[model samples]
Target: MADIRIVDVSLRDGNQSLWGAVGLNSAQIFQIAPVMERVGFCALDFSSSTHMGMAVRTDHEDPWERLRVTHQLMPNTPLQFIGTGLRFISWESQHPEFMQLAYDRLVANGIGRFVVLDPMHDEQAIMETARMFRQAGCKEIIGALVYTVSAVHDDAYYADLAGKMAASPNIDRVYIKDPSGLLTPHRARTLIPAIRARLAGKALELHSHCTIGLAPLTYMDAAELGVDVLQVACGPLANGSSLPSAERVIANLRELGHKVDIDDRALRQVCDYFTRLAKVEGRPAGKPQDYDASFLRHQVAGGVMSTTRRQLSELHLEHRFDEVMAEVTRVRAELGYPIMVTPFPQMVCTQALYNVIGDERYSNVADQLIRYALGRFGRPTTPIDPDVLDRILSRPRAAELMHEAEALPLKEMRKKFSPKLSDEEFILRATMPADQVDAMCKKGASKRHYNPEAAGLVKLLKALGERPRQSRVFIQQPGLTLDIRSAAKEAN
Candidate 1:
């Protein structure tokens, strides 16, 4: 039996897919830290710049303090982060010095591993990011190949690309990142070996989603072919659009004569905790799903799909989902078939939504699309449609974007801002708005303790009781009704 390692993604990608990336608060994460530490994961997919932004914007939580707390609890496991290789957290570009500072601060704050990716498959971009990560003292820099299905993205293409990345001195590991869950078992059988042949014995990990219900099969194939690590989520947060269940993966690996090192009892306890938390929060638990063929057409990432659905529903445009998806296919083709991952899928989906709802085609173009067309993001995998490219380039923003100067140096940026600020504060101020940072600094960390085993009713009651001057409360549900007046008010 061969030994295998696991990287847990329940806090990062799993939450992104199952809860729109805004689901788990710092308090909730703190509650599960001990159990997660006991589960014996080799690494924890803990945070990202986007997560930092969400923490500050939504919950006013201090992201740095969250990292400190996590490190305090899970000292043995390495915390991993994801980045776009350009921006720290914002969509716009930042100075190279600013990005370096962000990386340094991440390493200083306990992030030991970084999974850096460039959606356009730009080799230089990956190398530069890897170099910066090494300079920042990160222990591991994992170069990611964002997987997608396109005419130009065949197995040979990926093999060559993975080979180059594997050969880079700055990269400590390489992982096939299938964010959209488009990789099938047959493709894995062929692609994994081709990439492995060029690795020169470097560690290769497989990170795939369950969006199309083939990740389990794909994982099995990769393990059989001798991949080093398998990225998975715990049970309640696994399956659905997330990765397959870790416990299930371990059981399957054992059945297949592989030596798994995880603690099954601790794994079950973590799973049971999340199961209750999902119930209390009214969140959907991850479950196995049948394959959906339409996923190939849109190629929208599992995480983005849930968030997009919610946004459209809020605007009463849920009925136009199919139309928007169809438009995504057309727009993606016109824009050169960029992988449907972070920022790109968002840009494509926004443009498609505008096209579908507008009075005429190309009536509304998002700035990000114009930036993409102007070559700010990077070159496309394939040539964009000529006419569409011309139309996009003809926009006023395109000309402005074309003439924009290079990003400023770190020293000049510090002159503009305050050099007295700590590296963490400076990175936050550089990437995010000043007002948001100030608000987060003022509010401080949340004091709530999120008990995973608390019942939904108990949580609800506790929340209601915390409000001041609440005279009475009423609730009505199917065959249940209750009203309670405040004791002080009743006595008065």
Candidate 2:
């Protein structure tokens, strides 16, 4: 039996799938860092550009500081990050100098591995990102094949792409990423061997989700076909829409006569801590979900679904979710079925919601959709529907967009913005609004580390210690009653 290695995605994809990527703060991650470091994982899926943006926007935490602190705790382990080929975290493409400087800072802050993907399956863009990673001194660069079901994306199609990725000298590994959890065991039976045949003995890893309850079976099939690494998550963060549980995968592998090198005791400790932390924080724990065939239609990712629901709730349109979802299916096909991953899924869904709620179909198209039709994002795998294309292009903005010039280079951007700012600050300023950056800068670094379980107890004790002279503390439970009053009396 071949030995199988596991990459833990609890910190990155787990939180993304289960809690919308905004559930954990820097303090919470810091409290659990040491326990994660001891779990004997082959590598840790540490952070992503999305996670960094969420930190700055929602938690007011310095993303660079988060990386530096995480690296300090797990100095021996290789930390991995994910990004699109040209864009850092935003949907728009960034300047090449900005991309290079971001990569350099990441490596200097202790990121060792990068998983670069182009959502449009553009080979040149992926290779360019790989080159940038190499130039920035990253130790390992993994090219990603984003899996999706479409007429144009057959096994042969994927095999050809995998072959090209394997031939790239800059890429040390290739990742088959099923972010939507759509890969079934039956599909893996043929797809795995086809890609494996073209890999030329290069390392290949499988990263799938459990949204439809098919990933565990798919993982087994891929392992039988000689996949080198299986990406999984700890128990509290596993199953559901996240990856399969590490403990379950280990047991299944051993039952199948494969060898896995992991410390069971340490894994248990990590699981137990996270389980309690989820409860204390009032967050949902990952659980196995029954298969949902409707997922094949919308194809929204696990993480994107959470954010979508939140968005609908914010707009008071939660009741129209089913209508919006059905519209998404139609919209995806009209736009030529762009793979349901970051940026694309978000772009498609935004346009769909606009159509569903705007009182007239195709009356209000999003700017991103217009940009997509103009080939600003990338070329689509298949041709967009003619009617939809005409409607989008007929808009007056399309003419204005056609006349737009190229984005400014780094040198020009420096002059346009401020030239004195550091690359990190400049990049943030370029991507985010100045008010958001100012708010993040004002908050500064967090001083106190948070342990969810202990935090609740601390709050309760502090509340009990602050009783007024005339006030009495009352406690009543089944078969127990207690009352306490402050000893000091009010002066007349």
Candidate 3:
């Protein structure tokens, strides 16, 4: 039996799932890079446009530098970048020329594999994008069959898409992506074989969340059914909404008589470091949960759920979370249940929140919702509710959006920015607020090393040193001592 390769997603998907993509900074990642490199992962689920944006917006770290440095540190493992359709940092679609440049720069910076996730499962669109990415020098193109439990999404549905992707010259692999963690062992019994039979000789990967508590079992079933690889996260980042723990998954696969060749010592080091860092940073550790059937209805992804919670807490309406989720289910149905992936999950959740809080339902429809009705994205699978569609189109702004042309040509849009800017900075500037990008550039290089145990004491002593007229301060611990002196006092 061939050994099942592992792809570590702790930096990208796991961070996004549990920490809303703000947990790991460059220093934290760099400290673990050398060990992670030695652990023999087939690849690192390193970055996506949303994850990259989080680095810039939250940490004020230059995302490009993080990619380049990580690749330098881990020269052997491929770095995977998930492409959410044809967009960049923004949710809105961009012109082909614009997106091509984005892919070109990603390859240049060190992204080795491209995962194309079209939320709607538009086969033609995925193939077209795969072709473009292949031309952009992407080392591999992996197609995603985003899993959801809709009436129309059955085993055969996925099998057909897998066959289509396998036949495409541009797409090198196919993966079943269960962002909501809804795939069950029973489903896998039929789904995995159906897809594998159609994949010809190409490799198949399985990526599912731990949200509903079914993924761990499903993963075992998948391996038994010929899944080529299993995606996992490390230590504290594992479980809850994130993927399965790498250590546990490897152990189970081996017990099942499947060869999973990984360095146990290095894996233990990864778990220890992240567990310590989680304590130091006071970030929430993902805990395995009992299966909850309610999750199948809303189908909001773990990352999107955390983000929605944070947004609600910021507005002092966190207590109404149940109401928002209830509305999410309703809104999803009205919107024809667009698969719960990337922009669709985000869009559905936003509208649900608005409807929950607004005085009138659908009174304050989000532009994304309006754009969907305007056919800005691919058409919805089932027809949207006539009443909901009518209400959206009746709005005055919808009429104007209906006439909006495809994204301005790349050359014409480039004229809007400075000629001196690189493609990377230009893309960020065009999509995100200019001030955020400026702040990212101004922050310079990020710190490259972190000692979790010292983090708290260092921060506290630094705060104490900043006290007015404090000439010197001394602190002692069981094994460490620190003496701080102000610059003025030293000069004196």
Compute each candidate's TM-score over C-alphas. Answer: 0.89, 0.89, 0.91
Off by over 4 Å in 2: 301-327, 350-361, 416-420, 461-492
Query: Model 1, range 285-400, lDDT digits (tens) per residue?
Result: 88897998888779986556777788789999999988988999999988888998877989998888888889977878887888888888888988889988888889887888
The number of clashing residue pairs in each candidate reads 0, 0, 0
Tell me the tens digit of each residue's lDDT in model 2 across 1-492: 889999999988999889889888888888877778887788899898888888889888878888889889888779999978677767677778878888998999889999988888878888999999999999899989899987778899899999999999999989899988999899988988899899899998999999899999899888888898999998689999899999999889989989998888889988887888888777888998799998977898655677778888999999988888988888888898899986788888888888888978788987778999998878887889999999999999888887777656777777867677777777777777788778888998865477765676667556778744435666677775667665553222
Every model: Cα RMSD to truth: 4.0, 3.7, 3.0
* Model with the higher lDDT, candidate 1 or 3: 3
Question: Which regions of candidate 3 fall more than 4 Å away from where they truly are?
Answer: 301-327, 349-364, 469-474, 483-492
Query: What tens-digit string does per-residue lDDT give for candidate 3 at 1-492?
Result: 557999999999999889889999999999999999999999999999998888899999989999999999998899999997688888778999999999899899999999988888777789888988999999888999988888778888899989999999999999999988999999899999999999989999999999989999999989989999999999999999899999999999999889998999999999999999999889989899799898888887666888899989999999999999999988888888799876788899999888888898899887778998877777777889999999999999998888877788799989999999999889888889888999999999999899998787778776875678788888788987778777886887
- lDDT for model 3: 0.90
In candidate 1, stretches whose alpha carbon ends up further than 4 angstroms from where it belongs are 302-324, 353-364, 446-449, 453-492
Clashing pairs in 2: none
Most accurate candidate by lDDT? 3
